[model samples]
Target: MQTQGHDLVSTLDERTSNIRATIENVLVLPLSRHPSPRSVLIIGCGIVGAATAFFLARRGVDVTIIEREGPASAATGAADGAVSVASKRPGPMMVAALSGVALYRELLGDGTLTDLFKPRSTFVVAASDAECAVLEAHAGALRGEGVAVEMLAHETLIARFPALSSNVRMGAEVKGDGHAIGYRIVNRLLSLSGVTVLRGVEAYHLVEAADGRIVAVATSRGELSADAVVIAAGNGAPTLLNCDGVMKPRKGQLLVTERAPALNASMPGSIMSGRYLLSKGSQKGAEVSARGYGLVVDPLVTGQFLIGGTREDSDARQTNDLEAVRHILTDAVAMVPGLADIRLLRAFAGVRTAVIDGLPLVGRLPGRNNLFVAAGFEGDGICLGPVMGQAIAAMACGETPSLDLSSFDPARFTSLEVAA
Candidate 1:
């Protein structure tokens, strides 16, 4: 695939050069540029931070990523890596998802990061009438954006996925959505030229000057100075920020199944509940009310089934909650009957940094010129990683983001009056 894409790029370049006279006749605007930062300190080496470092390094910016543990050891290491556009909300989120998919496709063509991505179909099964209604609404909204969404009736869905429960009323299928290997992506990005990966060094606090620009960072190992800093520390951001309203931790528990003949077979990308889809922007009425379950069964290249997860409000780092694990497994079995025979392999948990608003804090910090943030992605960090990285690099380089960032402003939580 990499060779094929490269050949296409070369062929296109050659052909375009053949028509150089016509190309020269076309008008083009001067590209805007920014003074590159002398150095950038990224405070996490998860998927988000690693990708951010990769993008910044690609632009000739010096980037040092400091991780308390090894790269992708946090949420990125634990996530199921479902890169599904169907999982995202409509409008801005849909646009971001599409852009993120495109970026991943481009990366897939490089072979350097090929192990991190794979194409798979995704399905959303509806178990009840209410769920069916929600799926209809979701499919309708997605189709309006020209996204391919097929709504399958009960008989068709059951025939296609015999492992599904007979109670399923319908299912929504999205063809282009797929899964990626999160840890592999982290490794690939960390191997880039200009990225310096430092582990076992916990960043404790941001050292701000009188002018309110972050000048240095105080870590357990030592203090490091950089021209700019990005706080991509996932759930650990609140401790680093020490700001009451910046962000909070939301815990999610997941369980994995040992590879079995039934489970090892090729499966769709992922299946999300309608409740989960509509719960994005607003959490007020979106709380999982009934049994509170959303199960995503992702089949990895290694033949293991990555089944998950349950959302909780507590910030505890507990990974072995037998009850929560059982709930997740129970819900998963209900969604995919074949999963019932699979033996439980392991269970774990991770905390996602969630802000009051659904959007992530992806730009420069308010009042702190040199301090930038790309946290508060909740559980969707994997789906949004590449795009967020590109956007953060643009902000660090003083270039305008391709998308309007007002909706994700960190100031929405930390106001001048409140900070004062």
Candidate 2:
């Protein structure tokens, strides 16, 4: 077993000359202007913050992104870039996902996102009876919402995807979903937005007026007086806002294979498991797993296969979990035996903030009207980041958001607010 793992890594490096980098480090394209922002101090430079700055800049809002690190250095950088609705459990999460999917199409339609976006047919496969039932119900829910979904039975699953093993019992294909590299989207959005990015700075405290309106932020760099403050910091947002235990960091791992177009007809789109279903939130449709060892196979546009992951709730920055890698490999090989033959280029890991209820915080705090937060995406940040940014930006400009934010109110988890 040890020899096989060594061989897999060694063979891939020899075969592929160049493979794209994952989430820890995002490429920064040099920009000419660094505008002064008297409007809003947006903390965190990940996808959510960057997107907020992106749309806000378009609306002529003076926005500044203060980051402890560079852009896409958190969950946004480490994600598989799945703009998928298939993984979301039915209800509010699914509703936001549909809107997010539509928003991504609009972004792609414009010249904003070029070769970065590509259409994918998402396939959700299940190994057990429990998992299959969940997949079916998921397909039904999506269909009811006008999402294009088709169920593939055992025979059809094998016929369409010969790479999968005989044990594969069922599968469902989700249409109209697409894929994008997380870092690419963040880097491109920042480059195009031209917002002031203050890297290597930390937001220490959020200052507010006597009337409870947001005023300024005391940071490591200096005092940043702002008309408003939008906090898009991932796991760090809770700590800064004194809402610590509410948003916890959930770590994930993924392995990327070398360019192998022959790997399951280029693997079409992402292959998910019903096990993936259980992690989103409380769903009675079927019990998958809270930490879904669910398998996701993404065929990259560059002809690589991105397979992931294990969900661990810890703040430890260690991304390489040997045990998690083993489970991921075993799951990948069982579903698609062809994956065993392919060489693995590298394994990537990152942490995402997960809300216990499995929904992101996207609106204003109960008390601080001028303070807004967009965090706790847990792995869904890539899909919802753009729309969340657009919505938050509109709010900062004193305009109503385009999408319904009744579900993502930050006060839901607050004892006082919830009691009220």
TM-score of 2: 0.87
Tell me the tens digit of each residue's lDDT in model 2 across 1-420.
112234433433332211112111222222212232236778999989999987876665556778998898888888888998878777887888889888888988886787888878889888898887778888898898789998998999888877778888998999989888888999888777666777898988876655766566777865666566788999888777676567777778889989887774646677887777765442553432435566788888778889988777643474686877889999888888888888989998888888867789988878766678898898788999999999998876667888999899887877422110
Q: How many residue pairs clash in each candidate?
A: 0, 1
* Cα error, candidate 2, residue 77 (Å): 0.9
Could you give candidate 1's per-residue lDDT for residues 263-329 as a string of tens digits? Answer: 5563545666555554442222455332245667777777778887766665447465778787788
Instruction: Pick the lDDT winner.
Output: 2
- The lDDT values for all models are 0.71, 0.76
Q: What TM-score does each of the candidates earn?
A: 0.85, 0.87
Give me the displacement of residue 279 in model 1, in angstroms.
6.7
In terms of TM-score, how similar is model 1 to the real structure?
A: 0.85
Clashing pairs in model 2?
Answer: 23-77
